[model samples]
Target: MNLSDLRQDDLGLGIGLRTVHFGHILENWPDIDWFEILSENFMHTGGRPMYILDQVAERYPIVMHGVSMNIGSKDPLDLEYMQELKVLRNRCKARFVSDHICWTGVDGTNLHDLLPIPYTEEALKVMAEKVKQVQDILEAPLTLENPSTYLEFAHSEMSEPEFLRQLANETGCGFLMDVNNVFVCASNHGFDAKEYLRQVPWDQVLQFHLAGHSTFETHKLDTHDGPVCDEVWELYRLAHELSGGRSTLMEWDADIPDFDAVHGEALKAREYRQSMSSTSSSLEND
Candidate 1:
């Protein structure tokens, strides 16, 4: 896959459009490149969230990111949910629709968490087919984010990147590269983070997610509640250099501070991109 074949535009740095900052966003109209909406939040709503979204959609390029696609679930695809997602995508004119690579629940139960799937060939075929079905219904590529996993399935046949690479190849889907998750998973699972980044199919990367994670005695949790750590920032720098830059987003879902604070964190990615660009130019000249 050539890098130029990426579907979405390089939309610059943006933040997840949260209700906490709605007033500030509507009033100040801060200098942000785009906004990513949590798709389920607006799917069944006709209230203030939808109202704010309508207003924001008019001003910025919005992308729909969801947590409930459940692409890797054993159960069949959720048709009603897919229809609602289509409506929302059209309503907001979202550049693309995305969700986690893992399943959220099974057996008609909603777990409300991004649960990792085993990387076996059987699971791969199932997920790739489900992704294709989702794309067919939405009439667009379904970009998927890598999940922060706590444990690994011993029965897995392939590595994480290998599974994603083949899935993208089979379904022509896009990827939301979460650098923080990669770092957290690497630290937990004892793999080289840089090698994981190298294995990613960069051409299929549509967006970059940089968020803060909480470290416990055992493992790191993707809490998205604070500033991005320095190691994650370095991983973001590497991702920028690898993918030739993509639309970067900062997520602060929990304990989110004021609007300026979140946007300030998001702006750091812009600085990283600029620095990488300058260094690349200098190297080229040298």
Candidate 2:
């Protein structure tokens, strides 16, 4: 399948649609570009959550980011969940659907965590078939995000970017490149973060995820509980240039803050993009 067949578009700067800002959004109808909603939150709801979602969907562009697709599981694909996801997308008129590249569970038991997978030939083939199956079920390209891993498999064969690039080439799946995850994993695994960005399949990247992480004594964790740090922001600057710009979203899942603060943090992406444009103009004149 061709990259253009994915039908992904640049939606501009966005923020994750969290419950804390629902009332503010409903009342003010802020001038945000779009909102990325957790797909599972609305899939099984018929009460106030669904009502709030209906109102939000009418005003802003929605994209479904899920955590339960289990794309790499050994178990069979969950058809019932896939149907629910499709229905939610149709209801919200979501632009695209996304989930992590790692597996969530196996044997019909959900561990409720984004676990890492081995980057081997066998694993790659399994993921490719699962991605194609999901795309067919949803009738849209499935965008997968790179997870922040705490450990690496000893028997892994390739790097994360190489695996993702090959998967995209084989199955025509899009990617949600998380810049913070790159920085965190690089620190934990001792790889160069810039090199990781250089090897990504930029053509298949439909969006970028920017967030904050916490530093421990020995390693860093993907907390997403604070603002985007300078290091991660720098990586995002390079990613923005590499991808020629894409829809950027700020994720703050814990220690929740006010609506204005979260939205303001997301707006920092515009500053980074503008700086790149300014530098280019200066070089052209000189």
Candidate 3:
């Protein structure tokens, strides 16, 4: 859980590791800061997937972003999955490990989605303790992300930002702030995105995620299927300025476009971050 000297860098931008990019990445090997892997994709592998995984690890740093921790679930920890994660982290030499800050399932069931957690002290305590234990067991500091939540609990006691800040303060963990998630949640919950950024513990934020989302008539969902929206771009600007432009990633999962097309989006994220830096310098000199 030692983050005092954790090295942070804005490696420009990187897209989610998809199969389409494997050959080009391995043969041509485009220059990238790193690749973020969906842990479950390679969870049961021994063929081409694992081979490409190792090759990519050799080329660029890989970060593990998972969805099945269920850290906030009422059920007990999944020790088997934890062991598997440790093995994968070692194999990939991931820079860090991360997962959504909510439950995935309960009662030995797999809901296959990132669900919400009540913002109560009890839930906070449950999540923090479990996270601390996970970190200790994994021998690495866990990075919990504020997921895109579609609903709220009636018994919630604190705001989303408060819950995230408390998680860092109470559990000695790091954060992967997803700018797209914040925008979606704010629109759904009707909170101010800029205000949310101001409340975040930026020092504890090690990385940032930028992704595209689709909008429903009622709310914006984190579908990550289309181009990054202009509105989310604005919110990303705020997050970059607030978090000092922490390491950013471009994520597109479903209906993934061509490899070059996805990486093209990542390049766009780097451009946005460059603008944020210039703006910061101007304001400081004033």
Full-model lDDT for every candidate: 0.92, 0.91, 0.86
Candidate 1 stretches greater than 4 Å from native: 1-8, 283-286
Q: What is the lDDT of residue 200 in candidate 1?
A: 98
Runs in model 2 deviating more than 4 A are 5-8, 278-286
Candidate 1 local lDDT, 1-286, one digit each (tens)? 2224544488899899998999999999999999999999998989999999999999999989999989999989999999999999999999878999899889999899999899999999999999989988987788999999999999999999999999988988999999999999999999999999999998899999999999999999999999999999998988899988899999999999999999899998878899988998999999
Question: Which residue pairs show backbone clashes in model 3?
Answer: none
The sequence of per-residue lDDT tens digits that candidate 2 reaches over residues 1-286 is 3346443477888998999998999888998999999888898889988999899899889988999999888878899999999999999998889999888899999998999999999899999999999988877788999999999999999999999989987899999999999999999999999999999989899889999999999999999999999999999999988887888899999997999999999998999878877877898899
TM-score of each: 0.96, 0.96, 0.95
RMSD of each: 1.7, 1.8, 1.7
Which candidate leads in TM-score?
1
Ranking by lDDT: 1, 2, 3
